[model samples]
Target: MVQTVISVAGASADCPEWVLIDLQGSLETRHPVPLSGRFVGDLHFTQKDVPILIIGHHILYGKTVHLEKPFAVLVKKERSADTSMETDQNVSGTSYHVKALIRRKLLFKTRPKPIISNVPKKL
Candidate 1:
């Protein structure tokens, strides 16, 4: 019988804090383009510790929610299996490591409102 072996990567030394943002409505762009590395919006906190997200001319009210269970972000580790000398032991498969841990999220469930007043050029 043939068997497959999978290897697991080690945990990250520094577990960065990760927060999930839940938007009720979908974002529609004028043109179909990649949103990666693009400045989406600004997140501000009120005196009561509420979250407000301002994108374009729309403003969304949100609140912070604590997750019941935390999530771990995993990243695949790249390694070369080639060796100068062949050995009886075989190399393990690719592995992944925990990049970050998420314990909280910002939830925006209400509909966004258009900004009627003048917005500041810079915050």
Candidate 2:
């Protein structure tokens, strides 16, 4: 499956080209990644493999948000070298298998959850 990584995009007039991102642990949301900086210019974002262009006062600063494929190596480390060779069991011999194989991808924009208001309204 694919993974997410938040990277810096553009710079401000008074500040150098830099951005700070904090992936809040255990609180992952697919919403437009929250941004906090000196000057947050007007933004146009979507949930797709598209570049995130930061426009400041009509100037388009182009930068693409990237995604990574999750991976794992069957190789044993140097200190634990030959460990893999020692095990003659194939993947099927063990309980190892592909968890998921994503062929078709679909992304639907979810609506905000409704909430009940405590304040009474006019009849």
Kindly list the per-residue Cα lDDT of model 2 for residues 56-106, writing each as its tens digit. 323232334222442221222222345646754442222322222222222
Whole-model Cα lDDT of every candidate shown, in order: 0.77, 0.32
Q: Write the per-residue lDDT of candidate 1 for residues 18-106, one digit (tens) a residue.
A: 99999998876789988777778999999999999999989999999999998887776544566413523343344466778889999
RMSD of 1: 4.7
Which number leads on TM-score?
1
Off by over 4 Å in 2: 1-37, 46-54, 61-123
Residue 91 Cα positional deviation in candidate 1, in Å, after optimal superposition: 7.8
Off by over 4 Å in 1: 1-14, 78-93, 117-123
